[model samples]
Target chain A: MSTEIAIHIQDIHKEFLLSHSGSASLKTALLWWKRRQLEELKVLRGLTIEVKRGECVALVGRNGAGKSTLLSLLARVYKPTSGTITINGRIAPLLELGAGFHPDLTGQENALFNAMILGLSRKEATARIEPILAFAELEKYRDAPVRTYSSGMLARLGFSIAAHVDADILIVDEVLAVGDFAFERKCFAFIEEFKQKNGTILFVSHDREDVLQVSDRCIWLKDGQVEQEGDPLTVLDAYESGTA
Target chain B: MRSEFQELWRFRELLFAMVERELKIRYKNSVLGFVWSLLMPLATILVMWLVFKVFLRNDTPNFSAYVLAAYLPYQFIQLAVLDSAQSVLISLPVVKKVYFPREILPLASVISNFIHLLLSLPIFFIFLFVIYATYGFEVSPFTWRMLFLPVLLVITFMLTAGMAFIISALNVFYEDVKYAVSLLLYIFFFLTPVMYFSENVFYALKDKPYGMLLYNLYHANPMAMLVTAYKKTLVPMGKIDPGGGEGLIPMLPMNWPMFGVTVAITLAFFFGGYALFNRMKWRFVERP
Candidate 1:
């Protein structure tokens, strides 16, 4: 118990029932009203994994390979259809950049809102307000609605706020590809510092170099299965060769 | 159940932020800004007043005031319902990717419209005062009873928010709901006592005893009760004739019976919306 596992997942499985597009129309709605059948789309199969406190791990998978679904499960965005996750620490999930942001809201407003969504008290978030502005390099545009921002600007703003959140566990998904190279380098530096401070990090990226650079270990997922879990270099080699 | 409400409540700040954004954006690029909130109901009342007084030669007493009272409350209800219905559908990009209380989208619409309602209040009262001064009708002072308006609005809000949650969740699965809502509101307008009065329903249906049917519908419809309550409080209903007091009316006290009905039905809608929303919300992210 003292080992302090930040997250514990055992035998987790998820399945989704997707309806045909015509399910919404009144004609089909009436026809299928009684039958109520949905086409089955099995997005996630049975899987098991865990992460200890202060561990930095990378989750790698191809598109539709269930990496996003797994992250969603871990973040409790979607409850698992089966199995359970015991998460003991505060989780700040940068699940998708700008996910909670309102396009019409100013940058500063979005930051506070994003902070609150990530579970920080308004006052706590407000105290770091200046730092967030400085980090995003959007001090002049803080009052401008995010709609006015470029995708890179939006990503920068999102990354800045996500970085400032105080949490025991952080979950990041494919957002390293956002922003310019300079901003990306800055973000990687932040990730390295966070790793050094013993913050538990879970990230997913198709970029093997990124996985190798930031993660202490890597988990390679293929078709919703954990294909390999080990040092980033070896796992990437195996995943690449296997897919090849 | 407790945890559910706590989870929803804890995210109240997020709701406020979204509401603030909505209000600002709504008024920002426009020349009129907050005036548009006032103008919608004001213009509606002006048009109706002209039609009732000049064209029809209808001698209904304080017709201007009647239009103002009825129109304002109707706008509040309209704004709340329309915004709530679209909340989830519009915020799909955000809600699909992020995890927060899904109810906040519709709830935010309610708050933003409620702010617009607040902005429109001065206009409502100013018109009342103008009618009072010009026609020499004694005006009622601001009273504690006015506090009940918020209570009523809140109930209306919860009802709309819940419906918005349900409709939005449904709309996510069925895109046509977005188009259907506008048409629905068009029919809903006549159903409520917005352009016409409950008296008009009876007048139009007098030969068939249709007024009684309308009265029944009135009792069942929370918005009808609310509009009537607003009339009772704001426009003097000094007389309760069989046909909506054909002439001058005096301010009557708030109708407690209608108030009770409004409260009860609002609760019913809120719970109904909640149950439906909870049942449908899980399917939202996956639907599209």
Candidate 2:
């Protein structure tokens, strides 16, 4: 309940039921009714974490360590099985760049749609369209369908829209890994500026140097639970040595 | 439920944007563009007219208008339900990436199809005017009853939207929901009094033991009642002077009390569909 706590997650446990037959057709379901099997994949098990206002926290873990699951839960994209999550600020999630953009829409149109989906009004999204296009360096291709844009261009537009939302909390999940070096540098600069403006960030990345450069604190998830947390270097060093 | 509405209200802009996206993408590459909406229904009306009036030698006055009125709305509901059934599955990426009212996706489909239905209305009116002028069909002038068309349209929208919500959410869990819906629509087309008049069903089965039961069952469908109500309110504009000309076939003999019952049933579907959708939506994220 503390006012300073930007995100409060308590004893979070996430279990996904993996259907053996991926087809959701009624015929398949009826045929498999007697032999239907669901294997529960426990992604996050009783992991507790609290992120404070203006804190930049990085989650580092190997694949299947539930790093992305935790971020998704925090973003309210999925509900925890038996725990409560309280987020105190508007969140701008860059989980997967251009995940919501339609291929048929122009770059500017997709940016506006993505911004509105992230909680901006039509007028507000329209007003920010110019700045977003400018930041993404997509002015020349603003009218072109996004299907024609390169992957780097899509990432740029996605990052630009996410960055301009002016949200209290920003969640980035390895989105920077796709951008080119120059755009990555521009993104890092924006992240630093965002931090200076008192924004809370929950970043997930596998890059060691990038984690060290941006985060004030680090949480290492291991086998669905937090193995270590606190000082960035200490935890990262321990995590690296353990993985190595 | 109240909080859900409040949340939907907060994301109203997103809803509008989604609907706009659907409409634009639907007609994007087609040369005819928006005109296709009018042409598709007109083509259906033409085929139905040839089959009923020419081939069968049917004698229903203003048969073209009657078929167009019923068929246009039927096509709208069918398309809306069928397309919206896949709305959630199609937007899986967006659903997993962002947090908004998931209902907006299916709702947007409903609204976009509703727009198409609205666009086709003018063509329907023009068809009616042409039949009256050229064929000397007994067409009533516009009347005060036409004001009730909007109410009937709203009821139809609510009914289709509700079905879309239920089918689309269920579709995420069972992909066959779309196929099953399409099959059911086919059966429903024959069951409802769309292609034929309700009076035909009554007269054909009048001597049978369950004749009344069969007739009542036909009118029980909300869509049937809606079509009947639409014909009553919109098709028959005013009473034709009996001394000079023949009047249209008594507004297709609608059952008023059953119409009220159908309205209540549609409202119930809307509430039930909304409840089921809200309950099942959290499981959507769990699905692949």
Please tell me which predicted candidate would have the highest DockQ against the true structure.
2
lDDT of 1 by residue, A44-151 (tens): 777888898888999987788889898888776787889888888778777355876777778988888778777778788889889998988999999888888898
Candidate 2, residue B16: CA error in Å? 0.9
**B109-184, model 1: which lDDT tens digit per residue?**
8778877776777777788777767866565534455666776666666666666666776777666776687687
lDDT for A161 in candidate 1 is: 83
Candidate 1 local lDDT, residue B5: 78
Question: Quality of candidate 1's docking, in CAPRI categories?
Answer: acceptable
Q: What is the TM-score of chain B alone in each candidate?
A: 0.86, 0.92
lDDT of 1 at B118: 68
Q: Put down candidate 2 lDDT per residue, A114-231, tens digits, no spaces.
A: 9998989999999999999999999999999999999999999999999988799999999877578888899999999999988999999989889999999999999999999999
TM-score for every candidate vs. truth? 0.90, 0.95
Which candidate's TM-score is highest? 2
